[model samples]
Target: MQGNFWPDHIRRLIEQIGMEHPIIQAPMAGGPSTAELVASVSNSGALGFLGVGYLTPEQIDLEIRKVKELTNRPFGVNLFVPEISEAAKPSDKVLNCLQEFSNELGIDPPQMPGPPKYSFEDQLSVIIDHKVPVFSFTFGIPDKALIRDLIERDVFVIGTATCVEEGVLLEEAGCSAIVAQGSEAGGHRGTFGSTEGTPMIGGLALVPQLVDKVEIPVIASGGIMDGRGIAASVALGASTVQMGTAFLCCEEAGVPGPWLDSLLSSKDISTVLTRAFSGKYARGIKNRFIDEMSLLEDEIPNYPLQNSLTRSLRNASKDKGDSDFMSLWAGQGAAMSRKLTAQELVDALVSETYQVLKSIGTNL
Candidate 1:
């Protein structure tokens, strides 16, 4: 708890990323990851991240400046790697299915969306231009030349992987670290290697496998909420832990009131993985929307397309303070969430990790 409790390599990794603790706040892109939350966590000695995957280049620039103003400590920015091809247009059935939900919410039905306002290259240019300290991405790996560019700029690049195969691919692409995201993770599944269904590996089983395969440091993620989880991750050969659900209810997170209420009342069995909200699969608390969409699982369109279609309905639901229609993305550990300040949560996690390690007679 006091001096260098982590292994030498982990200590070096921590220092290299300018973090005092081996915790990295997961980048919850849509809304939960606020500037205040990111800064508060970084200020608490843990690395915080801004989920800028949905932001425009200009918006990303502004967000980086805001976090810098709040805290000088190092933090990270996460982007979503663009899919190789455009999503096929949805059929009438899929459109009608979404229309029913819009009618129920008394909002206008969604229309097909145009191309993304900005490209990944546009976003990456902004990140590089600002010289962000840590750059992490999900969904898939970036080009080798781009990865080289980031490393040359001294940006610590991190990539997310749901299985060992993906982790090995990331390492081969020159990632500085890899986040071994498990099936228990909340947001979009980062399973890109598979040609079939999404990978369903749990953190306990996935972390060590990825560590053994990849030479780069593996950061354990998924269902990791407390100090016990952190201790377990370290024991599994992880260099650090990336937690999202644990910080969703933090005061500084600025999550919508309805979503906050849902998390506070959730139980272990409340969450389900579905592509109801977005075409891509993600985990969130079960709701009428998800339940209804499950019946038409096969009819749903792929990501970005479905995501664009539902944007208005989601925004309307948020404005009306209705959780029933919200995405409500959360991990399996949502039941263990705590309503605390970011700093308080980080402090408690560090203290708890120290005690857990000490109690188990692990050498410091």
Candidate 2:
């Protein structure tokens, strides 16, 4: 029965990506998606992806080892492909804007460090050496040679696309699959071309468009909460469904208590996409910081620069369990989120998908 509507296509995708189900857990960085969470998702017959951003290669290695021990099934690792901020030395403008917001939160903003310094090469090497089964990336595409290495090693390479152009680029770069990230998606927007003002497209529209435009499989992400959403994605021609907020409510998510509470209480309008947190624009719960900071965008530094400046404030908020200051990343379907175990959540999603398909005569 599982193989009927889902069919050999999904099973083949699972075999290609080394998973049992078509569900891929969106890799959310900043301590939300953990190895335990990934392993749980993997062990439960779904693809689990660990967000390996903002960490050193050694730190990533440690997490890989931990997940490997916890689950014998195949798991995935998500990385933030490095991108250069368009602003040349926009630190002064960013610092001034950050100071005002820091004052509101009653915290001191850190001084401008020179430029962003993270070893993408080293991280790539670690992923290759460890031979992670599925490697998904966001922000931007890596060089062609790096893509070749992953392909040569038979790693399933997934790239993010905010627009059809980005999807085309990923196809050209040899990505095995594409995650069509809609405007409602949490975390950073994967708008690659423009450094500023990328047009926002909803998943309902973006998924089918990308599917028609690209040859590779398209995974629907953003605002996907339950089985109906999963079936809708499949009906729209998506091969898989990737969700973040759905899992954030799971026991394995390990987010702060206050953050979880906020997500639970949130309505559809509760989330917003703001560059206030990381200067790269991520969709999260609209809080005091995002509202006030959005008023002063001109002063915000570009991505890693603004990202570094607010690290302390975000950390403090996380430690103190203050949802107001923390970047509570979540999709618009947050209200539909249920507090369940990872395995339970996966089961629910699968069940819901079957029912939706049955209702639509796709599962017959």
Candidate 3:
């Protein structure tokens, strides 16, 4: 599409966010997300977000250094806000069950571990120290102190929200923009508070509704794989778009071979959302591991506990190139994804979007 197809607000938002293209590469924690991928996307005129959810402050700094070394293009970093509760802890029963799975996979299960804890404060400190151009987060909001600090550093903060209420909260907390993550998104849902039945909002419905609800620019995410999807999002009033699955198929995404192969093979019906991998709900291709976890859901521990317990098995599975135990995080748009370099993907998306817009103009 002609650049003017985008409104002044969208153009201003894109320029303010430091992206030549309105695409923002969604951060995929655990693996997949790498400095190479982030740098490539950013260099290709799109914004790349490095996933720092599971990394410590020091690690975050290291990755930021690596991204800077690879390219001087502005990129974003994503953090996971910590949420704690009694029920989220591991119970003896759950531990024993996890051990059983560990034995089956021939890997040692984790011993009794401490409660879930991560230095969100320290991570924020690193973000401030690095002075990244853009910051994005999911799971929940940070305190006012953290928010103020990020702003003081002149960091453009973006927060992910699954529902409109959460979007409003992000804006109230002084976010530069909001990522309207639909249920069709891969990886963990950014549902704040009680993880109720998040209205399974697809991009078509979610983007426009969220745009109408919030004045801040909305970056549409979930099940978006091509220029048609991007054009659709802009038509719905989104200033930009964020994508994870599309990048998963990129050369720079460091996922194991099985993961990429699965993405290539998956169809529309091959995916499901399960709390199997991490206790927290996420969407992925239905695999034997998830199927087994569904059968033993009641016995599984919460989040980090279960996540820790299965770490060895998951690692072993990846090493062996087995798809069964791999956490194949992918969205409904997986079927449309193509294996390409990150730069190529961004260029193709821009070209395709321009074509669609031109077609529409011709019709008019």
Candidate 4:
């Protein structure tokens, strides 16, 4: 066992989450994170995550049940904190523009989904009712009562932060740990309260700074693709590492073929942070839809609205086997992604980190 080899902090985090390794297969929501992938990674002794950000409460339960059926080991579920802020207000002009976009995609213009919106509160209740062992969230801080309830149930809670202050708030809100997500991270930017505060700090620079500022454990995220990255993060004071982009190419990832192909052929610096797809800043591959939407950036609605508006286009693109009009979310380190099964990837990560650490330790 590598028990004695782990640094004190990493060991503590591993014990905190009850994982055998300090690696966490990031919850790559919106389809890539499959139940099989989550189970395989957890079964490999690393924490697996189910990205429930886009799922309905019923869907969330079904996904959790599927993962439980596959593995008796501990795993986690990731959600987005619902933020009803004054970021963007709906306008008639915006609706017309969206209608035009719908016309271009040969789809019906969207109508308000109405009162019973997909409730985060509902999802949280499902997670609790099922006694989910680990829960994590991003976008904004979860309410205190929910945090307390999860703690009472012994759920190890994690929150995502794009900067030190965000991390501090999460720790203050009683998160078990904070995932310091740098600009290079894929999917949505987890910036909250102070959006400009942590616009785009790179992983190497962001992790250590947060570690210095916060008392809780910090997990490094963004552009991390291999064991070298993990070993480097530990040296930089990250207790563990959360990775998303690297796992997109794994066999069990529910990614479409065109999307997977782009990641497999991607190079460093190929991704950009854009809000054209989901109304919130997220890192993804540059594509036709992104380029076209860039011209209309100012009119983009707030996250929930914009995300709902474009859902059909992205979904249709996937069905048509086209990448040009799809949201190809990926991190900057996509070039380092390997085509392997989830278990193979986890094992490789562990072995590679062990070797890197061992070599460094010997030299020291």
Candidate 5:
């Protein structure tokens, strides 16, 4: 029953975005989401997302230019909502541990990174100036004025939510879509409101609930690996699905050779929610860094600070082919994943979804 309705709405939104499929390639902010990868995904009839959270406004312009060069299709840009946090300095003991870990990885003494590459205002301006087709935000909701400005410019706005209240807030704030990010998602937890009270809800539970509540279209994310997953989301009343981990193994991803190899080879990779990598709780493959830093959970500095502090070590680990020290982000569905081109993955997902629905109809 839920599957039959909302066609006109999703269809209009899809027409507005110029996407052939309702599938969205999750905007992985780190290294994996490259301009080439995003372009390829967009060219494949799906919405490609560029994670510009770490890039400067200049870099964002360059990447956008690159994607534009590669594909004439519409793609989306994701930004981290700017927040002001006070003195999130790490404790001496944790600092010593980080230093030792850096030494072990043969990394240079971590230079305290300058503040995040771009401010929200600067980045937002870049998007507006470029006349970006779609804009999405995480970490927290943007002010109503920003949303209004984007909407007034005819740019589709999407907000990520980890709970029902956040979804309601996004709808109220005028988002064209709400991405219900489940706990099984990799990279970062997009819990907007209270981080301390964030619910680690599973995708199936979270998607349907958000769908039931929101007036706008709800997108599902987290732990979705293949065709069956997409079908499941559609059945759960999601207008679309956003997948990050599934695309991690795609040929176009900018994942390090060793990290890609680790993702491909692992038959059963377990993920843990640790703030060790970025100071914000995110799910990633369990590794030595996470294990050794377990005792520092309470003291791990907040994001941007902790994220900047570990950049050198993460880069060094990638260079040295040490997966143990790398922030190997993967969702819970990593076990049943495959390596393919972006187009091939999307085609397979579409086919698999059809087959799953056919079988269900026959059985029922």
Candidate 6:
């Protein structure tokens, strides 16, 4: 119930982020992670995150200011590390598949997206200019120089890792902490390292491994939806836990109606890993888009390209209140999701964590 009860690493992280709880609301980019959601979670004594992966530098500045307005508590900003080269292009099959989806959604045919309006450096400038208390990144480790600058400015940097190798790479790259994102996590996979295939290690196995290999704290993520999951993460040596799907249906979350409804009704087997939505493996509830795209998994272009090609179609689906084409991102624990206000949810999680830990201590 108190910071003193937690391990030194956990306590240190909480203090470093100015949060009362060692919990972080996973930044769900594109939507779901709204300014209101971020602020509300931070106000609830846990760290919240603004997912600025898809936002321009200007938009990122505005969102950070908005969160500052809503909560004095420290929060974090998450970015997607740019990995795609300028010469990378989508294959014709990828474009034609998107075109078919566009026709079905009555949207214009897909086109190859131009380079980003701003570079990752531009985005980092906004984060540094604002002196954001916490910054996290996924997809890959950023350049050491940029990370050093952030650390020099006292910005607590967290990097996401799907495997121990990536975790070590992040530690060497100067990350203050690492988020051990399990395969069960929703949204985009944080895997950027070379692998035989996508790393499918679950949190129960991944957390302790990363903790053993890395000296810095490891934040367990993926399929962690409740206090029980949080306790399990701690037991496995994670300093804290990062949860996303658990908060997907929260009142302050910016989830679309159809996507929200899908999550509310999701079952244990409801989710599947697919690259259809973003060309990066992400777990989400099965829907028509994922089902149809499963056949073209090999043909789908890599991220940013595939993500851009389907942006209009996904938007059209959302606007039409259709879950078929919209990316219904949710973790495996979605069946346990509860619809509550951000404050109420955090309170519940803290209370439950206390109770669970107490019971475990007594039993041990």
**Highest lDDT: which candidate?**
1
lDDT of 6 by residue, 175-251 (tens): 99999999889887899884656798998899999999999999999998888999899889898899999999999
38-153 per-residue lDDT for model 2 (tens digits): 99999988988889887788989998999999999988888888876665455565667667656766777766666445588888788788888899888889998989889999
Each prediction's TM-score versus the true structure? 0.98, 0.94, 0.94, 0.95, 0.94, 0.97
Tens digit of per-residue lDDT, candidate 3, span 1-364: 4545567878999888778889999988887889999999999999988998888777888999999999898998898888774555566766676677677778888665655455888887787788788988998999867787788778988998888878888889988899999988988888884346645777788788889988889999999999998888888899999999999989999889999999999999888988888777889999988987786777676665677667777888898889988889999999998999999999999999878867777331
lDDT of 3 at 155: 90
Candidate 6 overall lDDT versus native: 0.90
Count of clashes in candidate 2:
1
Write one digit per residue (lDDT tens) for candidate 1, span 34-152.
99999999999999999999999999999989999999999999999998755598878878988988998898999888766779999989988888899999989899999998999
Q: Which candidate is the best by TM-score?
A: 1
Specify the poorest-scoring 10-residue window by lDDT in model 3: 193-202
The C-alpha lDDT values of all candidates are 0.92, 0.85, 0.85, 0.86, 0.86, 0.90
Q: What order do you get sorting by lDDT, best first?
A: 1, 6, 4, 5, 3, 2
How displaced is residue 268 in candidate 4, in Å?
Answer: 1.5
Per-model root-mean-square deviation over C-alphas: 1.0, 2.0, 2.0, 1.9, 2.6, 1.5
Between candidates 4 and 6, the one scoring higher on TM-score is: 6
lDDT tens digits, residue span 159-201, model 4? 9988887888898898889999988898888988675643688
TM-score of 6: 0.97
The TM-score of candidate 2 is 0.94
Candidate 5 lDDT trough over 10 residues, lowest sum = 1-10
> Which residue pairs in candidate 5 have backbone atoms (N, alpha carbon, C) closer than 3 angstroms, thus clashing?
none
Off by over 4 Å in 3: 1-5, 87-97, 115-118, 194-197, 362-364
Give the CA lDDT, 0 to 100, for residue 217 in model 5. 89
